[model samples]
Target: MRFVRYGAVGQEQPAVLDADGELRDLSGVVPDLAGGVLADLPRINPQSLPRVPGNPRIGPPVGRVGKLVCIGLNYSDHAAELGVDPPDDPVVFLKATSAIGGPNDPVIMPRGAQKVDWEVELGIVIGQRAKYVTEAQAPRQVAGYTIVNDVSERALQLERSGQWTKGKSCDSFAPMGPWLVTPDEVGDVHALDLSVDVNDARMQSGNTDRMVFTVPAIVSYLSELMTLHPGDVIATGTPPGVGMGHRPPRFLKEGDEMVLKISGLGEQRVTVRAEG
Candidate 1:
């Protein structure tokens, strides 16, 4: 089942996509797709839910995102592209929850920012609380997965940053979800393909198979460093082809558009806009 949330920004209602691809309202059944509600996903029958009257605006599938953890350079090619050695352990960082935005929303370029860039990452949504979880147990703690565009500002991140979070936590930076696909529905998480296109030109294309640290490994590694709670989102790093790694480098400007997709996780379309 593909879980979703639809409506205006703050008033999104829980919903699910039936096998026929029709939207079914889950608002009457679940309060929102977050925390314990994610754990109850298997118990709900999407087919039995009332059908949404027509196509509605889709919002970020999960709400009340507790923590947004990210892994840097998890892909071997991405590391190579940046002229950095792949880390033996995951390079972790935090993204402000305020950066969360609907998948197709406009991406705001910060004032005086010249290096705003894009990263297409696989987002892992935690279903249950976990601490010190073994790699074997990590998969069981996952609720599902979604696409994450890890939009960044290179000048803020690499040039003047105390921490990468400064470049990563801008409002509208993390555009997430078209649907939250359940773990069972996305068999073989590490074998999926992901790519990004800017203004119809393919900018990044790579497979999760190239990841230096696999999904389960990332989850387990993060568990040891911090307790992973329900509703916490972990962006498991991007494959090669980010703007920063391009020849002569390319950065986002007003009116630039980005389209990102991951197998089984749906797609996202984001248009760049100047911050007001």
Candidate 2:
């Protein structure tokens, strides 16, 4: 089932996408799609519901997010485009959980920053607690998957950064959701198509098939290093075609727009604005 949290930023209500792709208000029964609701998704009656009028705001399904993790250069082609060797293991980083925001909100740029870039990523949400789990047992630990922008300020990330978080953890940087698709519903997460578009111009286009590290491997590796708790989100990293991958190094400026999507997980379109 495609589960969603709709309404405004602080007031999003639980919602589920019906079989026909219409949004069904789940607010009547489930208050929100976090914690216990995520573990019991199978029992949801998506059909016996009312259609949501207009386009309700799509917030990240899991409210009150815990730790927000990210894997860098997980795509071989993305590594190639950047002219860097793909790391032997997943390159891990942490984005501020506070950076999380609604799926369609504007990406507010940081103060004194100009080199904003977009990365389309397949995000994994943990359902149960896991630590030191094997790859074979990893998929079973994941609750579901979602799309993430993994927005970055390239200059801050590479040139003047102590850590990538300086550019990665800005407010509104991580625009996620539209839906959190359960693992069973997504089939093989490895073969899906995904892309990112800036102001109607496509910037990143690729597939999960190109990922250097598969979902199970990423989860297993992460679990070994830290405990995976419920409501934790792991952004599986981006594909080739980031603005930084360009020869002239194209970067984002104010008033830009980004429409990013992944197959099966749905779409995320965001406007870009400078910080106040």
Listed in order, each prediction's TM-score against the native is 0.98, 0.96
Worst window of 10 by summed lDDT in candidate 2: 35-44
lDDT of 1: 0.92
Best by lDDT: 1
Query: What local distance difference test score does each model get?
Result: 0.92, 0.88
User: Against the correct fold, how does model 2 do in TM-score?
Assistant: 0.96
**Candidate 1 C-alpha lDDT tens digits along 15-43:** 88988888999878788998898876845
Off by over 4 Å in 2: none
Error of 1 at 22 (Å): 1.7
Task: Candidate 2: give the clashing pairs.
Answer: none
Residues 65-122, model 2: lDDT tens digits: 8889999999999999988999998899999988898888889998888899998899
Model 1 bad stretches (over 4 Å): none
